[model samples]
Target: MKFTNGYWMNRPEYDVESPMETYDARQDEKKLIAFAPFKRVLTRGDQLNLGATTMTFTSPVENVIGVKLEHFDSENHGPSFKVNNLDPDVAIQIDDNTASLTSGQLKVSLPLRTDFDLKFTVDGKLITESAQKAQGVIFNHDTKVSYMREQLSMGIDEKIYGLGERFGNFVKNGQSIDIWNQDCGTGSEQAYKNIPFYISSNGYGVFVDEPQRVSFEVGSENVDRVQFSTEGQSLQYYVIYGPTPKEVLHRYTQLTGAINLPPAWSFGLWLSTSFTTDYSESTVLKFIDGMKEHHIPLDVFHFDCFWQKGFEWCTLAWDKEMFPDPVGLLEKIHNRGVKVCVWLNPYIAQKSSLFVEAKEKGYLIKRQNGDVWQWDLWQAGNGFVDFTNPDAVAWYQSKLKELLNMGVDCFKTDFGERIPVDDVKFFDGSNPKQEHNYYTLQYNKAVYEAIKDVKGSEEAVVFARSATVGSQSYPVHWGGDCLSNYNSMRDSLRGGLSFLLSGFGFWSHDIGGFEDGADRPTPDLYKRWTQFGLLSSHSRYHGSNVYRVPWNFDEEAVANTKRFVDLKLSLMPYLYTQAAHSAHYGNPLMRPMFLEFSEDPNVFDNSTQYMFGSQLLVAPIFNESGRGHYYLPGGKWTSLLDGKVYSVPLAGQWVDEEYDELSLPVLVRENTILIRNEKADHASYDYTKDVDIHLYQLSDGKVTTKVVDLHGDDVATVTAKRKASKISVNTTGISGSVNVYVHSDNNITSARLVDGVAEIDL
Candidate 1:
C-alpha cells in the first residue's frame, strides 16, 4: 500500500495523482462538495484532459465528520457495514476563499484556490489535517491496480491504538497494519478481529468505512503521518471527535452499534471439554461434579468441536457415539444449574448430510461457475454456508433450533475467519473481498437471532471468534488459539484490551491458554491464568488436546480456581452494575489505564495494568515468580484482598511486590463505594439484599453508587457522604440488612437500613 519511496518522491511504478488545490466548491443542504484537480489548473485548457478528486463532507452523528474522496465512482455491491446514520443538522457555508462544515463541536475546513489542506478542528483547535500530497489516487502500472490513499498528519507524541485485538506493542505508532481478518493465533501480528478503526492518543478516532482490505501505515511509512489506503476507485472515512477518550468511544459506538448486555449467569465460570480430548456424557458429568466437590461455583459447561464427528462439522448435530443423548445430557447439566454451549462453524463439510442438501439447494457459497465453493483447509471438502441467503439462514437456524429445543443454551460461534474470497459468490452478489470480513457478521447474526427467538432478547449471547465493525452488538468474543505459556498469557491480555478499546463491552480468553499437548499448562501457569481469566468480563476454561479441568493439575490449581471463582461471584453486585453501565454508555468493562487516567503521562504506554471497571485496578501476575509491578496515579489505593493502603504522589508511583498463589493486586480507588456479597455462591441472585458496601478512603465528599439486579437493571442506589468524623449513608429501593466498611480504615462498620438511611461515626 506504500506508494512513495521516501518523503520526496513516489515509487517508479506508482503514478500518484494528488490534489494540488480546490478550484471550486459547492454546498447542498446536507453536504459540502469540493472539486480539486490533480494539477494546478492555471490555464483554462489545463482542466480539459485532467481528472479531479471529488471530496464530499457530511455528518452522520454529532461531532463526527465523514469524508469521501472519489476518483471515479464505481458500482458498489451491497455488503457494507451496518453504520447508523442519524444525519444531524449541520452548518454548511462556502465563502470566496474556503468551504467549511460544522457539526456540534467539530468542523471540517477545506481551502479554496490554495495548497490542499483539509483540516479537522474541535472548538477551533486543530486536531489533524490532510496536508499537501496527502490524498492520492494511485495507479500501479506494473500491477494494473488502482488505490485511493489518505494520509493524516500526526502530532509529535501522538500514539495510535486499536486495529482490533492486536497483540503487539499496545501503541501502534510505528506499525504497518493490514485490516484483514485472519485465523492467526494470539501471538502473531495477524488478528482474528481486524477492524479498520484506530483510536488516537489525541482524544479522537478514525474509522475507515471499508469492509475490504484497508492497509494503514501508522507513522511507519512517512514518519509524520498515518497513511491508510484501500484498493478501489474511492475511499471513505469518518473522523469522530472526543475531548476525552470515553466520549470518543461513546460517539463511536453510537455510529457502529451498542453492545447487548449478556445475561448475568454468562459472566460466571464456564468449564469446557477441551478439543481432541476424550469426552462423553460421563466425562462431562465428572468435571461438573469435580467442580462441586472442590467447592467451586460453575455456571456453564461447553462441548468443543468433537461434539460432532471430526469431518462432519456443522452437521450441527451430535455425534451419537460420543453423546448418545445430547438432549438428556443437556438437561442433566441444566439440572446442576449450569448452561450448555456447543461449538459451531459456518462451514459445512461434504461428509455432513446437510452439505449435499445445501449444495443442491444453493445454500452454500458458490464459485464463478455453477459449482459450490469447496475447500480442504481445516476440514475435508468443506463449503461455507451462504448467510446472505435468507432461506439458507433459516435452514441453518432450523438445525440450531433443534439443539436449542434440546436444552442447549448458546453456541460458541467459531471459525468464520477463513472465508474464501477468490472466485467466490454470495447470494446477494456482494463484493467478494468485502464479504470476507462481513461473513462473520451475517453468520453470528443468524445464530444470535435464532437464540433470541428461543430465549428472550436478554438471554441471547454468542462466544464468537471473528468480528468486524458492528460485531459489538453480539456479546462476549474471546481471544482465540493461544499457546500455553506466560508470554502467550500476556499477549492474550494485550489483545483483549485492544479489542475492548475498539468498542467491545465484553470479552474473555482461555484460562490456561488454548494450545498445548495434553497434560500441559504446567500447574503454576494454570494457577496464575485462572486468577486472570476469572477476573475477565467473561470467564471460560478451554484448551486444545487437553482437558482444562482444574483438578487435572496440582491441588493448588483447584484451590486457585475456586478462590477466584468465588471472589467473582461475591462481587457480582458491583460487577453487574458496571457491566450494565458499560453496555448503555458504550464504555468498555475492562479498559486501558490511559482511558481512565488521561492526564497522567505514565499510563499512556502501560497496558500491563488496567482499570477493571471504574473503581478497581487489577494487575495480573504475569511471571511465575509472582512478582507484580503496577503504577498508581496520585490518589489513595487499598488492596481489596489484604486491606493494605497506598498513598501515591501526584507524580505517580510504581510498586513491585510478590504475591502468593491465590493473590494479586486488586486495588480500589479512593472514595469508591464498592458493593459486594461475600457469602453468595451464585452469579444470578438478588443483589440488593445482604450486600457489603465498602467505602474506600472515606474522603470528605458525597459519592453515589448504583446497584443492579441479575438482569443488569438498576434496582437501588446507595449514597455515602463523609463529613469530618461522621459518614452518613442513604439508600433508595434497598432495605433490610447491609454491612459497611471503610477500606482505608481497614475495619467493618455495622449498619442497618432504617427507613432507607444509616449513619456511621468514625
Candidate 2:
C-alpha cells in the first residue's frame, strides 16, 4: 500500500500518473464533469497521444459531495452499501472558467482554466482540497496492475480517528491501515472489523466507497495528507461536512446505515460456555444455580462452539452426548427467565449431515473448476456457505430457524473472517477480493434476518465477530479473542473506542478475556474486568478452556460481579435511553473523550478513559495497582459512587485516582439529570416505576430527559427547569410515584411526585 521510498521518489517497480491540469469541463443538471490530462498539454499532438482522466462530482445529500475519479469507463460492480434515502436534488453553477456545486452549506469548486484542483468549503471558508498531484492513477511495474488513489490535504494539528476496531493506538495518525477483514486476534495491528472511513479533527469526514480492500496511509506516506487507494480503474469517495465529530458520525451512519436498537434484556449480564471448555447440561445448570446463589443478575446464556459435535461445526444440532435433550435444556433455561444464544459460523464441515445437501444444492462456495471449495483450518474439510446466493442464504437461515423453533433467542455469528479467496467463485459472480471483506456483512445479515423473521423485529439481535463498512447495522459486536491480562484489557478499550468512532454503537468483550496465555485469568484480573465488562453496552462473561462463572475465581469476584451487575440493572433506565439514541442518531454508547471534548487537546490521545453515554465518565482500572490516570474536561464532576465533588479546570487536568477492587472512577457531568430505576431486578422492567431522577448541579437552565421503554418508545419525559433557588419539575405520560433528588454539597433534597408537576426549593 505504501508507494514511496521517501518523499523524493516512488519505490522500485512503481509507476504513478497524477492529474496535472484540467483541459475541459462540462455540467449536467445534477453533476459536473471535468477532464484532466495526466500531464500538461503543450501541443495538439500531445492531446492525441495521451488519455485524460474523467472526474465527476455530485451531491448525494445535503452537506455531502460524492467524487468519482476514473481512468476507464466501466459499469460499476454490484453490492454497494445501501443509500436509498439520500437526496438527489442539488444546485450547480458553471462557467467557462470554473464550476461550483453547492449542497446546502457545503460547496465544491473546480477551476477549469487553471491547474487540476478540487476545493471543498463551508460558508466560503476552505476545509480541505485535492490539488497538485493529489489524485493519481498508480501502476505496479511488476504486476502491470493499476490503482486509483486520492490524497486530501490535512491541516496542521489535524488528527485522524476511526479505521474500525483497531487494537493499536487510538489516534490513527502515522498509521498504515488496510480495510481487509482477518482473524488475527486482538493482539496485533490486524483488526476483525475494518471500515473504510475516517473522521479528522478538522471536522470533515472521508469515506471510501469500496467493499474491497482499501488501503490508507494517514499522514504516513505524506505527512501533509491522508492518502487512500483501491486497486481498480476508478476510485469513489464522499466528503461529509460536520463542524463537530458527533455530527460527522451522525451523517456517516445516515449514509451507510444506523444501528438498530437491541432488545432491552440484552443489557443485562450474559454468561457464556467458554470455547473448548467442557459444558454439558448439568454444568450449565450448575453455573446458573451458582449465579442465583451468588445473587448475580443474569439474562442471557450462550453456548459456544462445542455445542455441536466435534468436527461438525454449524450442524445446527446439539451434541446429544453432551446435551441429551437440547430443547429441554433450553426450555429449562428459559423457564428460569433466561434467553438462550447458540454459537454458529458460516463454515460447514464434511462430517456434518447437511454438507452433502448443501453441496448438491450449490449452497457452498465453489472453485473455478465448479467444485466445492474445501479447507481444513478450523473444521475438518470445511466449506463456507455462499450468502450471495439467495437459496444458499435461505438454506442457512432455515437451519437457524429450527433452533429458534426450539427456544433459541439469538446466535453468536462467529468466524466470518476466514473466507477463501484463491480460486474461488461466488454465485453472483462478485469479485473475490471484494467478497473477502464483504462476506461478513452478508453472513451476519442472513442470520439477523432469520432471527427477525422468527422473533419480532424489535427482538432481533446478534453477537457478531467480524465486520466491514456498513456492518454497524448489526446490533452488537465484540472485541474478538483477547488474552486474560491487564494489557489486553487496556487494548480492548482502545479498540472499542476506535470502533465507536467508526459508527458502531453497541460493543462488548470477554469479561475475563477470551483466552489466557498459559492459565486462566487471575482473581484480580477477573474482578477488575468484571467492572469494565458490566459497564459496556452489551455485557458478556466468556473465556476459553475455563469457565467464566464469577464464583470460579473467588468469593470476592462473585461479590464484585454481583455488585456491578446490580448497578447496571439499576441504571437500565438511563442506559437503554442512550442505546435508543445510538440507534436513532449515530452516537456510540461508549465514546472517546475527543468526541465529547473536541476543543480540549488533552483528550485527543486519551484512550484509557471514555464517556459512558452522555452523562457519565468511566475510567477503567487497567493495572493491578488500582491506580488510573484520567482527564476531566472543564466541568463540575460529581462522583456517581461517592458524593465527592471535583472541579475540573478549563485547560483539562489529569487526576490519578486510586480505588479498591470494588470500584473504579465513574463521575457524572454537571448540569445533567440521570434517570434510574431503583426497583428493577432485571433489565426489562417498568422504567417509570419508582424512578429516581437525580439532578446533578442543575445550573439555571431547562433540562429535559426522556425514558424509553423496551421497544424504544418514549414512556416518560422529565423536564427540570432551575430558576434561582427553586427548580420546577414536570412529567408527561409517566405513571407511578417518582422521587426527585438534588445532589449539592453532599446533601439530598428529596421530593415525592404524585401527578403531572411539582416544584422543589433548593
Candidate 3:
C-alpha cells in the first residue's frame, strides 16, 4: 500500500499517475464531473497519448459528499456495502475556473483550469483537502496489480480513530491498517472486524465505499497525509462533516446503516460453557444451579462449539451423546428465567451429515473448476456456506429453525474471518476478493434474520465475531480471542473502544479471557475482569480449556461476581433507556473517552477508561497492584458506590487511588439524573415503578431523563431543574410513588415523590 520511497520519489517498481490539472468540468443531473489528466495540456499534441482520471462528485445526505475517482471504467461486480442514499438537496455552481458542489453545510470544490487541491470545507472553513500528487492511479509491475488511491491532508495533532476493532494503541496515527478480515486473536495487528472508515480529530470522517480490501496508511507512508487505496479500476469514498465528534458518528451511521437495538434481556449477564471444555447436561445444570445458589443473577446461558460433535461444527445439531434430550434441558433452563445461546459458524465440514446435501444442492462455495472448495484448517475438510445463494441461505436457516424450536434463544455467530478467497467462486458470481470481508456480513445477516423470523424481532440477537463496514446493524459483537493475562485484558478494552467508535451500538468480551489455555486466570484476574465485564453493555463469561464460573476461582471471586452482577441488574432501568437512545441515534453504549470529552485533550488518547452509557464513567483496573488511574474532565463526579465525592478542579486531573478487589472507578457525571431499581432481581421488568431517581449535582439548567420499558418504549420522563439552593422535579407517565435522592458534595439527601413532583431546598 505504501508507494513512496521518500517524499520526493515513488518506489521504483510502481508506475504512478497523478492529475496535474482539471481541464474540463461537466454537470450531469446532480453530479459534477471533472476531467483531470496525468499531465498538463500544454499543446494539442500533448493530449494524444495521456490517460485522464475522472472525478465524480455527488451528495447522499446532508453534510456528506461522495467522491468517486476512476482511472478506467469497468464493470462493477455485485455485493457492496448497503449505502442508504436519502437524496438530499444539493447546490451546484459552475464558474469559469472552479466547480463546487454543496450539500447542507459541507462543500467540495475543485479548480477547473489550473489544478488545485480538491478541498472539503464546513461553513467555508477547510477541514481536509486532497493535495497535488495525492490521488494515484498506480500499477505495481512487481505484483502486476492496479490500484486507485487518495491521500487527504492531516492537520497538526489530529488524532485518528475508528479503523475497526484494533488492539494496539487507541489513537490510530501511525498504523498501516488493512481492511482485511482475519482470524487472528486480540493481541495482533490483524483484526477480526476491519472497517474501512476512520474519524479524524479535525471534525470530519472519510469512509471508503468498497467491500474489497482497502489499505490505509494513517500518516505512516507520508507523515502529513492519510492515504487509502484499493485494488480496482475505481475508488469511491465519502467525506462526512460534523462540528462535533458525536455528530460525525450520527451522520456516518445514517449513511451506512442504523444500529439495531438488541433485546433488553441481552444487557444482563450471560454465562457460557467454556469452549473446548467438557460440558454435558449435568455440567450445565451444575453451573446454572451454582449461580442460583450464590445469588448471582443470570440472564443467558450459552453453549460453545462442543454443543455439536467434533469436526461437525455447523451441523446445527445437538450432540445426541452430550445431550440426549436437548429440548427438555433447554426448557428447564428457560424455566429458570434464563435464555440459551449456541455457537455456530458457516463452515460445513465433510464429516457433517449436511455436507453431501450442501454440495449436491450447490450451497457451498466452489472453485473455478466447479468443484466444491474444501480445506483442512479448523475442521477436517470444511467448506464455507455460499451465502450469496438464496437457497443456500434457506438451507442454512432451516437447520437453525430446528434449534429455535428446541428453545435456543440466540447464536454466537463465530469464525467467519477464515473464509477462503483464492480460486473460489460464489453462487451469484460475486467477486472473490470482495467477498472475503463481506462474507461475515452476509453470514451474520442470515443468522440474525432467521432468529428474527423465529423469535419475534424484539427478541433477535447474535454475538458475532467478524464484521465489515455495515455490520453494526447486527446487534451485539464481542472482542475475539484473547489471553488470560492483564495485558490482554487491557488490549481488549482498547479493541472494544475502537469498535464502539466504528458506529456499533453494543459490545462485549469474555470475562476471564477466551484463549486461557490450560492454566486459566489467577483469582485476582478473574475478580478484576468480572468487574469490567459486568460494567460493559453486554457481559459474558467464556473461555477455552477451563470453566469461567466464579466459584471455580475462590470465594472472593464469587462475591465479586455477585456484587457487580447485582449492580448491573439494578442499573438496567438506566442502561436500557440509554440503549434505546443509541438505537435511535446511532451512538455507542460503550464510548471512547474522546467521544464524550472531545474538548479535553487528555482524554483523546486514554483507552484505559471509557464512558458506559451516557452517565457513568468506568476505569477498569488493569494491573495486579490494585492501583487505579483515571481522568475526570472539568466536573464534579459522585461515586455510585459507597457515596464518595470526586470534585476535580483542574481541567484535566487524573485520580490515582488504591482499592480492594471489590470496586474501581464507576463515577456518575454532574448535572445528571440516573434511575435505578435496587430490588430488581433481573434485567427485564417494569422500569416505571419503584425506581430511585438519583439527581447528581443538578445544574441550574433543566435536565430531562427518559426511561424505557422492557420492550424499549418510553414509559416515563423525569425532568429536574435547580436554581441556587432549590430544586424542582416534575414527572410524566408515572403513577406510583417514587424515591428521589439528591447527591451533592457534602452528603446525600432523600425525598419522596409527592403528587408526581418533588421540591427540595438545600
Candidate 4:
C-alpha cells in the first residue's frame, strides 16, 4: 500500500498525482463539487489536456464532505452501489467562495477559492483540516487502477488507537495496517477483525466508509501525517469529532449501530470441550463434575467440533458413537442449571448428505466457469454456503433449526475468514473480493437471527470469531487461536481492549491458550490468566488439544478461578448497569486507561492495565514473578481483597504490589458506591434482595449515588451527601437498614439508622 520512496520520489512503477490548483466550483441545494487540476493552471486552456486525473468534492450525509482523486474513471465495472439511510432534503449552506454543510453537530466546510482548505468541525469548533498538498490521487500503473488518499494533521505527541482488535501494539501510531480480515493468531500483524476507524489523542476519529479493503499508513509512509487510501472511483469517509475520546465513540456508534446487551448468563464462566480433543459423554460428564467438585462455577457447557462426524460438518446430526442419546444428554445438562453451546461453520462438505440438495437448489457459490467452489483446508471437499442469497440463508438456517429443536442454546460461529475470493461468483452477484471478509457478517447474522427466533430475543448469543464494521450487533466474540503463555495472554488482553473500543459489547478468550501444546501451563501462568479471564466481559476455558478444566493445572488455579468468578457474579448488580449503559450509550465495558483518564498523560501508553467498568481497576500479572506494577491517579484506593485504604499523591508513579494466585489488584476508585450480590453460586440468581452497597472513600463535596434493580426497574436510588462534619444518607423504595462504613477518618462521633437510611456524624 505504500507508494512513496522519499520526499520527492515515487516508487519505481507507481505514479502519484496530487491536486495543485483549483479550476472551477459548482453548488446545488444539497451538495457542492469542486474541480481541481493536478498541476498549476495558468489559464482556462491549461485544463484541457490534464490526462487521466480527477478531483471531486461532494457530501454523502450532510456535514460530511468527501474529496476523491481518481486517475482512471473509465473502469466502470464496479458492482451496483447501495447506501441506505440518507437524508436527501438535508440542510446545506453555500456561498460564492465557500460552503458549509451541517448534519447534527458535525460540519464540513470547503473553501472554493483554495485547493485543499477542507475543514471538519463539531459544534462550530475546528477538529481538523487538510492544508495544501494534503490531498492526492494515487495511481499504480502496475495495477492499472488508482486510489483516493487523504492526509490529516496529527499532534506531535498524540497517541492513536482502535483499528479493530489489533495485537501489534496498544498505540497504532507506527504500524502499517490493512482492513482485510485474516485468520492469523494473536501474535501477528494480521487481525481477525479489521475496522477502518481510528481514534486520536486529540479527541477525534475517522471512519473510512467502505466495506472494501482500505489501507492505512499511520505516520509510517510520512512521519508527520496519517494517510489512508482505497482503490475505487469515489472514496468516502466520515470525520466524527468530540471533545473527548468517549464522546467520539458516542458519535461514531450513532453513525454505525450499537451492540445489544447480552443475556446475564452469557457473562458467566463457559467451559468448552477443547477443539481437537477426543471426548465422549463420560469424559464430558467428568470434566463438568470435576469443575463443580472444585467449586469453580460454570454457566455454559460447549461442545466443539467432532460433535458431528468428520467430513460432514453441517450434517446437524450428533455423532451417535460419541453421544448415543443427544437429546437426553442435553436435557440432563440443562437440568443441572447449565446452558449448552455447539460448534458450527458455514461450510457444507461434499460428503454431507445435504450437499447434493444444496447444489441442486442453486444454494452454493459457483465459479465463472460454472463449477462449484471447493477446498480441502479444514474439511475435505468443503463448499461454503452462499449467504448473500436469501434462499441460501434460509437453507442454512433450517439446518440449525433442527439443532435448536434438540435443545442447543447457542453456537460457536467459526472460520469465515478463509473464504475464497478469486474466480468465484456469489449468488447476489457481489464482487468476490469484496465479499471475502464480509462473509462473516452475513454468516454470523444468519445464525444469530435463528437463535433469536428460537430462544427469544433476551436469550440469544453467539461466540463469533471474525467480524466487520457493524458486526458488534452480534453479542459476544472471542480472541482466536493463541499460544499457551503469559505473552499471549497479555496480547489477548490488548486485543480485547482494542475490540471493545471498536464497539463490541462482550469479548472473551481461551483461558490458558489455544494453539500450542503448552496445555498444562505453569501454576503461575494458569492462576494469573484465570484472574484475568474472569474479569473480562465474558469468561471461558477453551483450548486446542487439551482440556481446560481448572483442576487439570493445580489446586491454586482452581481456587483462583473460583475467587474471581464469585467476585464477578457478585458484582452483577453493578455489571448489569454497565451493560445497560453500553447498550443505551456508546461507552464500553472494558475500557483503556486513556478512555477514563484522558487528562492523565501517564496513562496514554499503559496497556498493561485497564478498568473493568467505572469502579474497579484490574492489572493482570503478565510475568512469572507474580508481582505487578501499576499506577493510580491521585485518589484514595481501597483493595477489594482487604479493606485497606491507601492515598496516592498528585503525581503518578508505578507502585509495586504482589498478589497470590487467588488475588489480583482490585482497587475501588474513590468517591464511588459499588453494589454486589451476596450470593453468586448461579449467574441468574436474584440480585436485588440481600444486595450489599459498598461505599468507598468519599472526599469533601463529593456526592455518591447507588441504583439497584428494584423489581425490573431502577426504582431505588440511594444518595449520600457529605458537607464538612456530617454525612446525610437518603433512600427511596427500600425497607431494610443500610450499613455504612466510614473510611478511616477517625473523626466520627456517632452513627444512627433512621427509616432505612444511615446518617453518620463527624
Task: State the lDDT of candidate 1 residue by residue for 1-762, as single tens digits.
Answer: 688888888999999999999988898779999999988888899989898999999899999999999999899896889889998989998998999999999999988988888999988899999997999999999999999999998997998888899999999999999999999999888999988888888988999999999999999999999999999999999999987889888998999999889999999999999888888889999999989999999999999999998899879889999888888888889999999999999999999999999998999999999789998988899999999899999999999989999899999999899888998888999898999988998999999999999998988999999999999998779999998999999999999888988888999999999998555699989999999998899999999888888888888888899889999999898899999998899989898998898788899998887898899999999998999999999989899888888988899899999999989999989989988888877788788887777888878989999998767888899999999988888888775577777654556566665777778877
Off by over 4 Å in 3: none
**Candidate 3 lDDT:** 0.91
lDDT, candidate 3, residue 138? Answer: 96
lDDT of 4 by residue, 364-479 (tens): 88888868899887788888899888999998888898899899999999878887888898887887767877888889989999999998887889999998877887778999
Q: What is the C-alpha RMSD of each candidate to the true structure, in Å?
A: 1.1, 1.3, 1.0, 2.9
* Candidate 2 wrongly placed segments (more than 4 Å): none
lDDT of 4 at 648: 84
Q: Considering TM-score, which of the candidate structures 2 and 4 is the better prediction for this target?
A: 2
Local distance difference test, each candidate: 0.90, 0.88, 0.91, 0.77
Q: What is the per-residue lDDT of model 3 for residues 80-144, given as tens digits with 9 covering 90 to 100? A: 89999989999898899889999999999998768647999877788999988899999999989
TM-score of each: 0.99, 0.98, 0.99, 0.93
Best by lDDT: 3
| Clash pairs, model 3 backbone | none
Clashing pairs in 1: none
Candidate 2, residues 135-188: lDDT per residue as tens digits? 888899899988988999999899999989899989999999999999988889
Better of 3 and 4 by TM-score: 3
